[model samples]
Target: MWPDTTKVVLRQGPEVHIRPMVAADAEALHRFFLALPEEDRLFLEDDVTKPAFVQQLLAEQEAGRAFPVVAEASGEIVGYGVLYRPLFGWSTHVGRVRMAVARSFQRQGLGTAILRELVRKAQGLALDKLVAEVVEDQVGALRAFERLGFHREATLGNHVQDLSGKKRDLVLLANDVAHIWEHMEALVADFEPSAG
Candidate 1:
């Protein structure tokens, strides 16, 4: 089981609370998505701003199909990360990760911190590998994942379309969970809980 909630200090010197998203978070999660820029929402698989979409996400969590974590600051959701695992399939040992951070909070290590929490969850679940799909133009996301030890496994041509119906190449990055754990352990400094 994940912890009830924890706090981490970002590189920018602000602290954010991280916790597993609960069913009651549907409304706030929707608001968070609605606040995202169109460019940021373009590559998302689903229309997260829709209340129905948020409800579906909560249902997925209830059914154990998805595990989502959220970061809150000043009582508002600013970051989100989720792990998608197949319960029964040829690749049950693999989990797909997706993350998003508020535009105002970008470049402050919040994305990395959220990903770290998901990685810990993946480790606890004994997932062998974690994979992330990124559009070619999402350079920041690509770099963030790369910094965490993810390597390009494949790049599919025009595999996804943007909000404007523009087809874009999709890059798949994957890393062994154990390898990621080792990298995290070897990080120059760990983000420990903030002292109140």
Candidate 2:
């Protein structure tokens, strides 16, 4: 089972609460997606702006295949840590990660905060590997993944097209659990509630 709730201090120095996605958060998640920039939305596999995709995501979460969580600052949803694991597929042992942060919050350590939580969850699930794909133009996003030990594994040129009809390469990054876990353990420890 996923952990209850935790608060993280962003790299830019603000505390925000994060917790696993629940069915009731559908509306908030939808609003969060609609608030993101067009460039960020263009590369998503699903049109989250539509109610259908959000429903599908909720269904997937209900079935235990998806484990998405939202980060909230004050009273608004600011980001999410999207994680998934296939139940019976060939890649069942692998965890897939997708991160989204509010535009104003990007590059301020929110992405890293969300990712650290996801990595800790993956480790608990005993996953063998974690993977994330970033569009070539999203240099900051790629760097955020790298900060957590994700290394480039593959790059597919012209693999996806953006809204401008321009093709973008997909940068595939992977982190082997064993090698990255030691580094992430310290972070997991930091987020734990104090024993006081």
Candidate 3:
């Protein structure tokens, strides 16, 4: 059996709740993906309209190979986060995170809460590290990850080109769960404790 499941209770100022996504959530997930801005969509590769694609993602989550979480407010999916297994065998212990919160919900602490939950889930899966790739211009995303203990590891030059034919740099960030835990005390002290 795998190690204990890592579950992080997410609270968004007492209004929204975050939980693991299920197969039944495919349609909602699709809607969220479809609503993403073109710039944000460039970071993730997927065809939300395909049932096979959704099924594959759901299967991975059920098999302990990935995690798909959804943020809901009044029963509506407003944000989503995913942590998937690494591609290379040697890096199996590492996981990559992809997250997006609806534009209306951005800057309201939902992103931070979702990131914390991603880290919590990764640690629970016995993962050694969590990685995120953010476009260089996504200052908010970069800062969010940095505030959550992620450190910039590299910058992939011109990794993506938008519809406008403009190139963008992909900034890689990584966090060592063990190292973060070692400084948990100080970190907790820096932020006021709030119930999740």
Better of 1 and 3 by lDDT: 1
lDDT of each: 0.86, 0.81, 0.73
**Residue-wise C-alpha lDDT for candidate 2, range 1-196, written one tens digit per residue:** 6776877766666678889887888898899999999877778766778978778878988898788889998878999887888999799889999989999878666776777778778878889899998888887778878877889999999998887779989999999877667755665465433211
Model 2 C-alpha lDDT versus the unseen true structure: 0.81
- Per-residue lDDT, model 3, residue 22, is 79
Q: Model 2: runs farther than 4 Å from truth? A: 185-196
Report RMSD (Å) for each prediction in the order shown. 1.8, 2.8, 3.7
Q: Is candidate 1 or candidate 2 better by lDDT?
A: 1
* lDDT (tens digit, per residue) of candidate 1 on 77-123: 99999998889979999999999999998877788778878888998
| Whole-structure CA lDDT of model 1 | 0.86
Off by over 4 Å in 1: 188-196
- How well does each candidate superpose onto the true structure, as a TM-score? 0.94, 0.89, 0.79
TM-score of 2: 0.89
Please report the TM-score between candidate 3 and the true structure.
0.79
**Better model by TM-score, 2 or 3?**
2
Local accuracy of candidate 3 as per-residue lDDT tens digits, 87-118: 45899899899888888777666776666666
